[model samples]
Target: MRTLVSRLAVALLGLTLVAALAEPVPAQKRGGTLTIVRPTDPVSLEPNLETTAPGAWVYFNMLEGLLTLDEKMQIKPVLATSYEVMSPTKVRFKLRPGVKFHDGTPFNAAAVKFTYDRALHGTPPARWASLAGSLAGAEAVDDLTVDILTREPYGPILRTLAMYCMGIVSPAAVQRLGADFSRAPVGTGPFKFVEWKTNTHVIIERHADYWGDKALVDRVIFKVVPEEGARMIALQTGDADMVLFPSPAQLPALRRDPKYTVHETTGIRVVFVGMHAGLPPLDDVRVRQALLHAVDRQAILDNIMEGSAGPARGVLAPGVFGYKDMQLDRVYPFDRARARALLGKAGFTPGPDGIGGGQGAVPRVGHGVPAAPRQPAQPPSVHAGLGDVERGCRLLALRALPFEAGAAGRVEHVAV
Candidate 1:
């Protein structure tokens, strides 16, 4: 009797929290529309087809995932009332009983199964199918009970489900709309899709029948202002409430403004350069080591990033799963003598004309070369061309180099 009462009390508490969230926002903090700007438009609004952040920025408002990450990055249930690991490769979920999609269809275990099936094996596979990660199948055992089976005992399953792409959608709406579903998204979230004007803006309105917390704003407008100056101007003129990823140079002015607040949050993005070790000069290991010793990573981080960025170790950032820190002392040290010696050992030395050349020598750039320091240990050959540039410009610069340069690519999702 005691155990039964405790379980019932916990269920009642959860219901109370849900009911409290459904109440309207207080009059003092309600009714205005919030407007923001993005650097570019989303490729597609359909959660399954889109693989970019712009799409996620808009869709997140209109969908609810089975699980969600809290401010501390811990997994917490959203659509799912509770879940249990039935076995090494299987899991079971108990759905919240009264939730409904924006279009009036009931939200249940069946809807969850349908969403995952469409994502994994629909007419065309979802763009990020690998995000499911070793999942073999999901099935509805009852209206509110679901069983998920994976090919292995995947530890990141809860985190994967928390991603915006895994948000559940109304099966009836999806079947009715087919390919057009991208434009007519229907889910159980605080906001409902209103309209999207290509290259211009996307609009969403508060869902009055939302199962969770009511939206604080009446509407949200995501406008596309590609130019950095234009985005700042919009914020200054009160045309936009927020702007995404403003350039580093703009921070000083924004930080000093008394009327506005600046929010600097931790993110998990890393930027690094890749070398083509198979090509001519780079094919030599000594040449690669020489180049690594010739560059100053700290100077770039301080001057170009204005101190917002940190020098990269390996490819992965700190605190990510499986990350092992590279010992800085053991890695290549910035020594000009060592770089020159390596080049000479590989049969390269400076000619009378002052340009570095010999058998198998890497060509040297003359202009903008920093004067060699008095100490032989200091590197003076690192190029200024390395500072942040556009994708097209970076590719062009790389192609123009004597060595082959690859285009910049984005690093997708990360797990912990």
Candidate 2:
């Protein structure tokens, strides 16, 4: 009874907090619209089956995962309010009471079992194996609880669970909706899927009956404007509330204006061109270094990006664990002379006729190189590219989706 009272008290506090947060939401209260820009399209909404970049992050917000992450980036309670590890391989979940999917299906132990089963037997499992399979099996202990078994002592099991791949879905909804599920996600999130017009926009209405604090915004409208300049223009013209990944060049224009404010957040996404290593000239380390060095990093920052982009040091962006700043070692110094020398060393000296190297055709370096008489021309495919909560679930899902992949590729569903 005391624990119940404590839960009630916390619930009341969350309600109060919701009001406190919403009270001053001037723009949100107006309920005009929020045109959010997210790169790429969603492949599918079957939580365990999502593979695209946007789908993984967005679905987590629209769905609930078994495990969750806290604001401090620690793993915490989400769908299963609490758990007991009977043994290293065995664990139990205490489901949150009264939570329901948009389809009105109860989010219970059976649902948990079904969700993970699909995850282990899904298409994108390879990308999310750790998070989705921390539990080898799940059994409904009761209507409101379930038990899970892990194959091994996965070190980051809980953290992995806090990813979109581990997000829970309804068995009923999956059966009824099938592949169309992504178009109308029905998680217990603060927002419910309202409508989506492919390549145009997506609209999500705030869920007033949310288990946690109700969202401050009445609605979130994700707009699909591809160009960097157009996104800022929308904000400037009051057509958009926020822009997700603004190009660097537009920073100055925004800074010079009063109606717009740019919020730059450094995240765990590395934004850099991936040159195919197998490509001819590029195959040479000197060539990669030369090309990178030839391009003025400082100029790109100053002219194109307006210094807003965090200087990428390594493959992984900042905030990611084990990421090291190896830019200095990996990148060549910004010296035209060095670039010229490197090119020359490769047997390609700039002769009076602007060509060189006793070679056959400018050796195609990376994925797609023009076919030389001696070599075949081809392009390599290097471009390929998580979740939570009940109340804790929402928190974890949003946090994990914090970074922006930027406008990397064509708008597709599964970025994986």
Candidate 1: residue pairs that collide: none
Model 2 per-residue lDDT tens digits across residues 1-416: 00000000000000000000001224434334445664445555545445545565456667777777664456777777887777777777799999988778888888888877776756655445553545576788999878777788755556666765666777898789877876777787777888877767777887777787777668777767766567656655667655544544445554455543333335444444455565455567775555445544444434333444445566654455455777643455456667656665665554444434444233222122211110110011111100000000011111123122213422211111
List model 1 lDDT by residue over 1-416, tens digit each. Answer: 00000000000000000000011224447778888876778777878877666788888888888898775567889999899999988889899889999999999988999988888887677876876788776899999999888889999787778776888889999889887889769999899999999989999999999988898889999899877678767766677766664545656655565544444443434433345555555567876676566556565544544444555554554534444557442486656677768767776666564444576234322211111111011112134321111011111222111122123332211100
Each candidate's number of clashing pairs is 0, 26
lDDT of each: 0.62, 0.52
TM-score of each: 0.72, 0.65
- The number of the candidate with the highest TM-score is 1
